[model samples]
Target: MDAIFNYLDNMFAHLPKTEEVVRAKNELGQMMEDKYNQLRAEGCSDNEAVGQVISEFGNLSELAEELGISNQYQSASSEDKFVSVTAAEGEAFIEKTKKAANKIGTGIAAILLGVISIIFFSGYAEGTFSPTLGGGEPNKIYIAVGLGLLFILVAFAVYLFVMTGITTEKYEIFEKKMVKLDPHYKLIIQEAKENHRPVLTRKISIGVGLILLAVAALAVSGILSEDNEALLISLVCVLLATVGVSVWLFLSGGMIQSAYDKLLNEGDYTLERRKSESVVQRWASPYWSLVVVVYLAWSFITADWSKSWIIWPISGVSFGLISTIIHAATSSKQ
Candidate 1:
């Protein structure tokens, strides 16, 4: 066990300057040292004890591989823990964002189609088509083009969803391996539940990402045009995303930063500290609720009636509100 511990410590000492991998390796080395010390107290020889522990551990090569240490001696510690609590939450958020993008894309395509149809009808009712296509019926071509764009966007969304699933699997496997390496795994999980910082961070990232993403969608729908109704809707999304992020930071930053500061001071990871998720969620819920309401109201007012798309924003807001309420209620219980 001492030999194994020494080997691990030496391995970590030579690894590249990655804090996470180094930290995990140090933690593992410490555990090995303590275990070896205990066995020695029971009168085991250095060779016998080392042999026993090495056999028990199976292979250092496998341990290094599982921990993602490319060169058993290199540093890659940050990859051990989920980069942040928000990482998993980010996955779910990204999935929702992709769906929202698809819906927005589809809605814009349909509206464009309907408008072009109206244009063609109006032109036919009169004497000739518009000068844009040299007085020809460009309606069919426009419709086909709009449909093609919509399909392509839809396919892109499907691809994002698939990639999200794959990334999620990789994260889960990495998380499991981290737990295996850490004896205090359960405590860390409980701490995460109580902290809630990671989750909030994820929501914040998602909201921000969506807002930026909506810019492209807005350009597609002509919302970037001055005084367009779509402009107002796009503005609303931007505001919601911005407001949500601000609220998240307000709720989470101080607490998470304080905890992190303590970690930095300690210079080692410990799973003893705990906080309450309810505390953070309660502070954030009302603000999020307000943003949700504003968004829904905007969506309801701006959606096109000809397309019967009024329900989209309403449903989105309702769901967001319900989820927030549920999270608040559950966190309080915890």
Candidate 2:
């Protein structure tokens, strides 16, 4: 009976580790064991009984089809074959990439807007624009800063609205209980690693290089230019270039990472990892929203735009700490 079960395990090892397949394997083993025992009781030798039991059981291909595990097996019939799991994983990966692009765009936009607002209001305070408006009167400066803050808040709200739907959709895929990969999955993964990884690495390198070059150019332009208007134009060009490279990197790099996850049966969708991730996801958005509110209120009350930028890095660190604490507490309770 142990030998029969071991043979069955070896036979079906190529299939994904799903619940239905596991149940079918157990039932089949029991049936085979009973048949083997019946043959032995009929005065058959040990070898004869084993042979008879296996022969009577018939071919595994037909049984695999009945059990819905035929998808992993190669067959002459095309209709019986289902789509590859990797294909679905690919679509999910693309969605994740789009979500990442949105996140990056939102963050970059906010940072750029913050810097622009500071520069504009600071100049307005010193009468750099429109000398006729009382030469940087405190009242005028206040109005300019107020308008800038309003723009920033509006941008943030729009970002949240647009990205919430994308984030929710991506999470839906991650929440699913993924089965283990097929035995042959490693072969396909090996091929992908050989063929795709080098290309992806090169593209990422190029993208990063472009961004760095743009930043360096912007820095040099700012340092050399005595004219504020010319420096602003150069900064805008640099920002556009940086954004293009960033989008390219996010799309390409995300797909590569997703491929690795699918092949290795690891990453966010894996059972153990998803449990901790779910807890963090539940609290992250609200925590960040509160942080944003605090940041804006503090900046406005104190009129200290320069120092208020520190809130973002502090909040990021605090969010990680909060996630760790929540995970520990939940794990201990469980």
Candidate 3:
């Protein structure tokens, strides 16, 4: 029986795992096992029974018609160019994407935290920089330290973003090209995404709630007197912190969902969208690179860090419009 099973395994080892091939393998495996058992029961030795089964079973090519995988067995591996993924690899990719999403979300949140630290440190230091409280040195020391930490945190965040991309580079094929998912793994992948959907909704809801809470804080702050500088700054910092947390929650949920989309070729990663986005992708890399250059150049040249950050928010909003217009134009042309 073991020998018969081993022989069956070797026979199908190189075959493309089309649905027909998989079904054929199972049906043939059962037949082979039954035949081997019948021979053994008839007083034949193990080796003789295994030999008889192998001889009778012949090869996959000969039995292709009976198994209904004749065409698939002959041409699938040669003609099909779509990528295939193993169940183990698919699960591992999902887990890896979750970790990357968490890391990226945390990094984005850290940038906001860094901004809060800068404002808080400078505000606190400047207020107490008098001769009686501390000295004039507190202002310089506080601003310098705050700025230093901000740059360091930003650098670390960028490093994480880059590393995640590099580590997952091999899986880019799923995004760049169509994937012919093995029938055996489709149910597994669908089950995983379905299970993860509820959690995704919860995370997104929590994120929206947090953003609303941040907005309410600003309203409360605005209602109070403008004379209280410390109180105003404190409320503003709280708002930033709240929004950072919301962004983290949103990205964490979105990233995992994006992983499922890539596997299923649905949502933003659909085959049609992927084909259309090839044009947008070409524009995106340089557009962002130019934005970064402009941001840094304008910030340093004007010596106005506060207003310079507004470029990010504006660019972000405008890019959505730009991409949408591009998508519509390309889609309409087709």
Best by TM-score: 3
Return the top candidate by lDDT: 3
**How would you encode candidate 2's per-residue C-alpha lDDT over 1-334 as one tens digit per residue?**
5555655776677777778878877888889898889888898986676656655665567766667867644652353322235545644554565566556556555554654466456545644455554443365655577457757756784776577555656444434444333434333444555676677777678777776777677667777874664355546445554645565575556555654564454554454555676888889889889987988798778755545655765887788798878777766766
Per-model lDDT: 0.46, 0.61, 0.75
- Find the 10 residues in a row with the least total lDDT in model 3: 126-135
Candidate 2: which pairs clash? none
Off by over 4 Å in 2: 1-89, 92-107, 123-135, 138-171, 179-264, 324-334
lDDT of 1 by residue, 1-334 (tens): 4357655654456456566676777776676777777778899987656655544543345556555665642443544532333434433533443444444444444433433333333333322333454444555565455345544644555565466455445434322222222212223333444465676567567755765665566556663464454344434444344434444443344334333322222211222111232333455558656754664355346522222223435555775676566655755666
In order of TM-score, best first, we have 3, 2, 1
- The better candidate by TM-score, 2 or 3, is 3
Lowest summed-lDDT stretch of 10 residues in model 1?
265-274
lDDT digits (tens) for residues 1-334 of candidate 3: 7666766776687677878778888998998788878988999998678767776775466767865667765674465535778778888888888888888887887877776766666666666223354447646777688778878888888888888888787788877766656543554566678898999899889988986887687677778765666676677677778878877888888888888888877787765688677878898999999998998688667744434656766888888899899888877887
Clashing pairs in 3: none
The RMSD (Cα, Å) of candidate 3 is: 9.2
- Model 3 has an lDDT value of 0.75
